[model samples]
Target: MLGIKNWINLNSSSVFFKGTRIATDAYGKDLLVSLYRKYINGYPKFFKMDPLSRLGFVACELLFNSEKVETLQTDNLNEDSCLILFNKSASLANDKIYNETIDNENYFPSPSVFVYTLPNIVTGEIAIKNKIYGETSFYVIDELDATTIFNVVSSSMSDTNNNRCICGWLECSNEDNFNAILLMIDKTSDTLFNIENLRNILNYK
Candidate 1:
């Protein structure tokens, strides 16, 4: 069998993404307060679920956008495209918190809280929303670095089955703070964006 196609570097072409809902507004103001002023009952989605779920929701919203959908479904790569995700915070934080509610000796493990115990569930949710059947994986590490991110992304694309790839770094802590960065990549681009620059672009460094 032929060797897997070399992975395309992220900076070689333009990447598209949608939705980046941070705790602060675009103007660097409090987002929750801003939502309250514009609504009568206040925004419930942000406060109702764990911060990780909220981040996953935003990721789903981005991947499910009309433009992204068109690109994902219509565009064809050389069979070296895949999906890679890097995450720092594990789902255990939320699980740990929710387990406290029932672990007080009276209740058993609550299914509601037990569901978010797996970090990869977030990636699975995004795939379901976008209908993406490509290679999917989630990496949990202590920190996000250029080498680690580049290696995993390269490995995913190194497979002959992948023609293009979408790679990202996602992090969410129980403190209601979360951030995600996504990149869409393919071969055949004249431009080149190095890993270091890509990391800088995503503020990962």
Candidate 2:
């Protein structure tokens, strides 16, 4: 069975891990910045990431550093771990930002905004931060389809023979609406990792 060792979800409301809400008063972007300052003050590059990348980066930090996972050393060293993320908006938020920079009236394209137009860039950010050498891919679908996500993740894990995988739904449609469901999964026959659980987490408050 593919069991979930640790999981986290964050939205405009709050953040949760292991079914317990993390103690915090901050919300939205402020919440992310707070988490970074509390746990990742040394990573200066995190300040320069796009909104989506920043969201995913913080989620990874919270998920991996938790006590549920003991393979931290091998988790970073092995090449079998994979990252598979699903998003409803494929960098549309950043695309709109970049488009504004080159509008008919402005006619100026900022390269900085242009760099984050790819949805996979968030996955790249996570992989780079964790040194994951295995497959890392991002899918843009109409919504958080649990069946599709389960199929892709199971297939990828099998193909890579990965003992551990970072799979979840991550999306930032805009400033007002953003969501992240990050999970650390391992192939152990303890906790369940099925479609129903995926849907529950994706729809969690």
Against the reference, the lDDT scores of all candidates come to: 0.54, 0.82
| Highest-scoring model, lDDT | 2
Measured with C-alpha atoms, the lDDT of residue 31 in candidate 2 is 80
Cα lDDT of model 2 by residue, 7-110, tens digit: 89877668899779988768787888888998777889888888888888988888987753446445545477888999999898889888889889889987
For model 1 the TM-score comes to 0.67
| Highest TM-score against the true fold, candidate | 2
Instruction: Give model 2 RMSD, 1 decimal.
Output: 1.8
Q: What's the lDDT of the predicted structure labeled candidate 2?
A: 0.82
The TM-scores of all predictions, comma-separated, are 0.67, 0.92
Please give the RMSD to the true structure for each candidate, in Å: 7.7, 1.8
User: Model 1, 5-42: lDDT tens per residue?
Assistant: 11211111111232222232321113323433433133
- The residue pairs in collision within model 2 are none
